[model samples]
Target chain A: AQSVSQHNHHVILSEAASLELGCNYSYGGTVNLFWYVQYPGQHLQLLLKYFSGDPLVKGIKGFEAEFIKSKFSFNLRKPSVQWSDTAEYFCAVMDAAGNKLTFGGGTRVLVKP
Target chain B: EAGVAQSPRYKIIEKRQSVAFWCNPISGHATLYWYQQILGQGPKLLIQFQNNGVVDDSQLPKDRFSAERLKGVDSTLKIQPAKLEDSAVYLCASSLDSYTIYFGEGSWLTVV
Candidate 1:
């Protein structure tokens, strides 16, 4: 069974602060990775996805993640965050064999204004 | 284009009672998924459908939960003899293939 682990449960930061969220998965084969964000009172939307190429994938709203196959990690980073970035972020993995997407325990980010 | 659609945004039912949630996938999407998200946790996939056929349902608790996607479009997830732990958000998602999934505003269920 493939599982995802997110290192942070809750993070408190101020506006203009740089942020990095760690995500590691326990899979060896080819897999697809994703970062999904859920704003307050809103549905979950895809922030970015990595299927095959480019270790570093840039997503919407100045967000980016790097897929490191050696470490089995895909960490999300944002150089500067705003108050609007306060939300819950989830890291997900889809194993190529079964194609089942498994999500990690989410990280609730609070960007203080 | 419109995203996935779910009905009955909220429902409250007593224990051992039955409840159902409906979902309509995005137009032209062939794959649909049903997920259960307990508070403070990420969403878990309960079942997935490729058109009218079941693709994956390994995590579904078959004893009290059942879901069906008929006509390859709309789907219904039913829970009978609901338990207190069953209270969570039922999220419906759809995708053109196996990759990027678009989610709907989940239907919240509270079992009292």
Candidate 2:
């Protein structure tokens, strides 16, 4: 079974502060990774995804993630965040064949204005 | 296009009661999924359907849970004699292909 591990459970930062959330998966084969965000009372929305190709992938809302195969890590980063970025983030991974998706516990990010 | 649609945005039922949730996947989508998300945790797959046939239901508690997709379009998930632990959100998602799944606003369930 594949599992995703997110290091931070909660993070608080001021507006304009940079943010980074660590995500690691336990899959040994070709995998597809994704970052989804859920604002308060809102449905989950896609942030970005890494299927194949370059190691770095950029997503909406100025967010980006680096896929390091050696470490099995796909850490999400945002150089500057806004108050609107306050939401819970989830990291999910699925096998290349597009099987079941495994999600991490999730990281709640609160950006103070 | 209209995204996935779900009904009964919220429901509160007593223990041992039965509840059902309905979902309509995006048009032309061949895959539908039902996920259960407990508070403070990510969504977990309960059942998956390819068209009108089921693809996976391994995580579904068959003893109390049941789901179906009719005509390869809309889907319904039901829980009979619900338990307090079943208090969570039920999310419906769909995809044209197995990957790139799109989600809908979940239906919240509270068992007291």
Report iRMS values in order.
Answer: 1.4, 0.8
The lDDT of each candidate is: 0.95, 0.95
Tens-digit per-residue lDDT, A10-77, candidate 1: 99999999999999999768999999999999999999999888899999999999999999999999
TM-score of each: 0.98, 0.98
Model 2, B4-110: lDDT tens per residue? Answer: 99999999999999999999999999999999999999999899899999988999999999998889999999999899999999999999988788999999999
Give every collision pair in model 1: none
Interface RMSD of 2: 0.8
Worst 10 residues of 2 chain A by lDDT: A94-103
- Candidate 2 regions exceeding 4 Å error are none
Docking class of 1: medium
- What lDDT does candidate 2 reach at residue B100? 81
